[model samples]
Target: MRISDIPVPDTTAARGALALATEYQTPALTAHALRSWLWAEAFALVDGVTGVDRELLYVSAVLHDIGTVTEFDNHSLSYEHAGGHVGIALTAGAGWARERRHRVLDVIVRHNWPSVDPSMDAEGHLLETATALDISGSRPGDLPEVFVREVLAAHPRGALAAEFGACVVDQASRKPDTAARRLVDGGVVAKLAANPLELL
Candidate 1:
């Protein structure tokens, strides 16, 4: 796996999140998670976003999509909520305090939100914006084009657009009132297909 120049935050909690994602998530999903973290870091730097809990954001990045994977998929709950629960369990295993664990859960769940206020939760804001960039190429100009190509070269999209889209469509089919449904109704799958990042 070629890694980009971006230095992923390495901490015990971050490592744990990576391990869990690698073990349980599909390769496409894993790469998306990793890229999400990279995008989060890059966005933070470019936007002068400071004082964020880097480890928390990284952990949320890697764990954010695991719920969509087969083993962790919750039939009833939306993928983000299920993933949030998984994040809480994983962080609790790492001995995080209640507040920290809650933060992980909130970040994971809110990453799918329409928008997150940076002032209220910097980590959530970063994760939400980061995922948007990766999944739909939102705010593409925020990071340098060269840096984006470097990241894509390291963690190629593979079948992420197809894989994630199919999973989300299925989720929407089953859970009509979820964010997944909203995303589907809102043409998210089409946006994924046409994501400029993939074209790059």
Candidate 2:
């Protein structure tokens, strides 16, 4: 489904989460986050994945990279780790039960991984795949061209490539043991080079 067609939940907590993400994240990251959620939702609709908690998915998508913001990057934690913590904290105030809150945390933490088995959690799996498609341009055929065009038209990529690359490189430099560093050492550059997307 197109993002315009899918209604984002109108809960007060959802609004607060979006505002917080907008306040902290860079413009590129904000756009990426929204696009990630849209891509995930689109894939889910095509695949007939059901029972997704739309609010949690939206919040998780928006806050997935929150740790990249300087205010949240005070420690040596990987951006994913920090982002997961932030997600938990943000949802805790929303009065979610412990189990539901942790599910959101799982989505944020697992999104950085190379793959997410759908059996684990449909939302996380969708978010992970969507992130990969957005960043590495993997599985371009999985999404319709019209949907892709609509998404990009709504949220232009602009400097997302350079901005995201620099963020990951900087994280790798700061914390060699981080996933960012591992990805870099494991040939992320080569992967990006092979990506068909015109990231520039």
Candidate with the greatest lDDT versus the true structure: 1
lDDT of 2 by residue, 1-200 (tens): 46579788898657867898889887878888998999899988887888888998998998888888899984688998888788788788888788988887799888888788887788898899888887888788888887888888887776777788888888899988888997777766566555555542
Tens digit of per-residue lDDT, candidate 1, span 24-72: 9889999999899889888888888889888888899999988888888
Given candidate 1, what's the lDDT at residue 177? 84
| Count of backbone clashes, every candidate in sequence | 0, 0
Note the residue pairs that clash in candidate 2. Answer: none
Task: Give the lDDT of residue 19 in candidate 1.
Answer: 90
Measured with C-alpha atoms, the lDDT of residue 71 in candidate 1 is 89
lDDT of 2 at 95: 82
**lDDT for position 191 in model 1:** 89
